[model samples]
Target: MTTTTELRVATDGLTKRYGGRAAVDGVSLTVRAGEVYGFLGPNGAGKTTTLRMLVGLVRPTAGTATVLGRDPGDPSACARIGVLIEGPGFYPYLSGRDNLRVLCRYRGLSDAAAESALERVGLRARAHDRFRGYSLGMKQRLGVAAAMLGDPDLLILDEPTNGLDPAGVAEMRSLITDLAADGHTVLLSSHMLDEVQDTCDRVGVIVAGSLVAESTVSELRGGTTIVVRATPYPRALAVARDVAGANRVAATDTGIRVDADAGVAPRLVRALVGAGIEVFDVHSSERSLEEAFFDMTRGSDSTGDDPEVSR
Candidate 1:
């Protein structure tokens, strides 16, 4: 069981409205300590709004949210939480290291904190490069490094990999993973399904201002099922049904689909082989995060007055 102390962030029916329409409607989610939690949604969904409310950048129209056991925007809580929302702002003339140093000073932290943050984000080598000359990926890394200035307990990152090349995306993914491994609770919001699938321990999917699903990457994608193909179609089908209960067996276009794990695959092959059915191919099929997201938000579509616009 999860205790309140174990939760880094918790929201109950948390909502935000723009005029009459809701930008975030009744979202209840939890982020545990020292885990990477992904907030996933299509563009214009309520992800940003929900995050803003948690960080106290925006007030909730209804419901309650607790960050590090305090109200959103609480000074004490804010001190313990690091945030990087949208694009980061840094002076064009300032070096990456200097940029973090300025933020550190604002936070009442020492220059050493800035240097430590730069090293953590792999920006130590380019520490002296001006912000204007940095690549988009480098700038994003610097933003994250700035967020790490004080070694805050939680990081609330909104679209950390927004506009990056494939290599940059991979680097960001690795950095997020590294942060989580170092015992920092990370709340990452992104529209990229594959990135979330690869990086997040669990995910909350919001669609059209509503959270429709929340679960681990594996659970959301569903369990693995065995697909079998054999020469004797009819015989193979019968053997599959008998081996893996009739209810768990279904005939596909080429062969049989067994609603069972890979452990049942060997048994299935043996049974078919014993029955003189030549097994052609057998593999396990598991849905991707993209597939699961589509399944969860099949009918939802975003309209005017989104969270970003309202912000």
Candidate 2:
């Protein structure tokens, strides 16, 4: 009972090969319109290859992909999508406004759209400045403006925050969230799991060119560990053990750490109180997306598995 409107991007058995090896193997993914889909993986995990195929930069060696109901490489399909691949490219001597104008000209748009695009990226005040004079963050924003020129329905950005300071990273994250909120479908690829977890509505993780997990942030954090602190460590440990199915219950310097199922926090509190343990504080230790990424990608070398091809 799925509707066409529910799917913005779809791939089936997508594979890409190089020589005798596969750069991307039989991978399939679907993204809905207005949904922020995150592609996570380590370097050389085929994330870039998959995105290239999705954008028609490289033809798949084996599988098929569609964007907005048409082949990604189709000129009509490409027109509806905006992409900021690698980093933003511009003429060092050209003003920000001029750079966008150049892009618009190539896309068959009037120069009027260039100014508006600059405004959208919060660079209106500095629109006339040469690209060489802008900071790394400013350059990144300009790149985003270029991508927004056609007012495309879908946006694909890869590591948009690369080479930015902490504040720049924060700003980029906010801008991305705002883009999605404004009804733009975004497909983001990043090695920074924390950024992805914070910004994306759903995440698909790849390891060694193979999809290892796909889920919402909440679903991925379903069984996170909760750390409980009490006056007496041993007493807390004993009470934690009494709680049914408390795995890895151990006494730490401050209190006891236990891995338990979701919705068991309240139950643990009551059990500890009933057992006469002096409970000082209770808190859940949710795993950050970075932690989750490590857990998912650990023990696998980047080149361990042969790549898959999609034509």
Highest TM-score model number: 1
Q: What residue pairs clash in candidate 1, if any at all?
A: none
lDDT of 1 by residue, 131-241 (tens): 999988888888888877788999999888876788778888998898899999999998788999999999999888888888999999998889998977988999999
Candidate 2 lDDT (Cα, 0 to 1): 0.81
RMSD of each: 1.8, 3.5
Which candidate number maximizes lDDT? 1
The local distance difference test score of each candidate is 0.88, 0.81
Worst 10 residues of 2 by lDDT: 302-311
Q: Give the per-residue lDDT of model 2 (tens digit) for 120-237.
A: 7778999999999998888988988888888888998877777677776787788889888888899988877778888899888887777788888777655667788875667667
